[model samples]
Target: MKDRYTDFKEDPRFKIANREALIGCGVAVINFIWWFGFAYGLGSKPVDTYTYIFGLPAWFFYSCIVGTVVIIGVVILMVKKGFKDIPLNHEGGDDL
Candidate 1:
């Protein structure tokens, strides 16, 4: 039997995977913070029927509509600039 244990940190695939995961986590954390701040922090204020934003509550407008658009744009930009495609398989080499 041969030992399969090896230093994975030195592998390119490992590094790429880690980088991608960190980027994903960062996006998630930002979204969570934004949502929590708007939903709980700002939206907790006393309700007023007189105030309207786009025919909706100010909190809903910022937290759902605007936040979604901003998050979409952010993800698109991150994917376009932050990630490199790795081939799933290489000719005469082991499958990824």
Candidate 2:
């Protein structure tokens, strides 16, 4: 009997993948907090007076429109700065 499972800790690509995964998770968490906080936190305010932003509620504008733009920019920046391109054939690996 032999240990069949490979240890990912010894693989060079493991660190890169781990870093990218962490960045992706962080982005997801930030987006979740931003949207939820705006939708529930701000939308729950008193409606005594009508407040409109571009014919929509301020909460909707900030949560959906503005948040989307900001998230897009953040994703682009993360990909450019945090990711590296490794050639698939460098180690005789099949190109998928």
Candidate 3:
């Protein structure tokens, strides 16, 4: 092992951080796609031709209500299963 240094080239924490960042970006992109697809797909129709679910527009119900529930569940599941709560301390160093 190399001597004590604040910065290291092969730190495993870097990998974890990069992976989590990518996951966050991917989740954001997926959320945007879901909102856009439903909003445009259903909202594009004539107002009088639109259908209502629970007194909300089809697009609003599907994109906002259902999407929020689904996305929250997905994010919770991902954080619980895919993420690691790594300690933010250096190797052989004092706690930070």
lDDT of 3 at 25: 89
TM-score of 1: 0.78
Best by TM-score: 3
Clashes of 2: 0
> Mind giving the per-residue lDDT tens digits that candidate 2 earns over 1-96?
236575433667767888899999999999999999887776888875537799988888888988899899999999999888865464747776
Model 2's alpha-carbon lDDT is 0.83
Poorest 10 consecutive residues of model 1 by lDDT?
1-10
Rank all candidate structures by their TM-score, best first, as comma-separated numbers.
Answer: 3, 2, 1
How big is the positional error of residue 24 in model 1, measured in Å on the Cα after superposition?
Answer: 0.2
Residue 68 shift from truth in candidate 3, angstroms: 1.1
What is the Cα-based TM-score of model 3? 0.83
- Against the reference, the lDDT scores of all candidates come to 0.78, 0.83, 0.87
Q: Tens-digit lDDT track for model 1 on 41-60?
A: 66777886335687988777
**Model 3 stretches astray by more than 4 angstroms:** 1-8
lDDT for each residue of candidate 3 in 1-69, tens digit (9 for 90 to 100)? 457784557887888999988898888898898888998999899999999999999998999888898
Task: List where candidate 2 sits over 4 angstroms from the true fold.
Answer: 1-9, 89-96
User: Which residue pairs of candidate 3 clash?
Assistant: none
How much RMSD separates candidate 1 from the native structure? 4.8
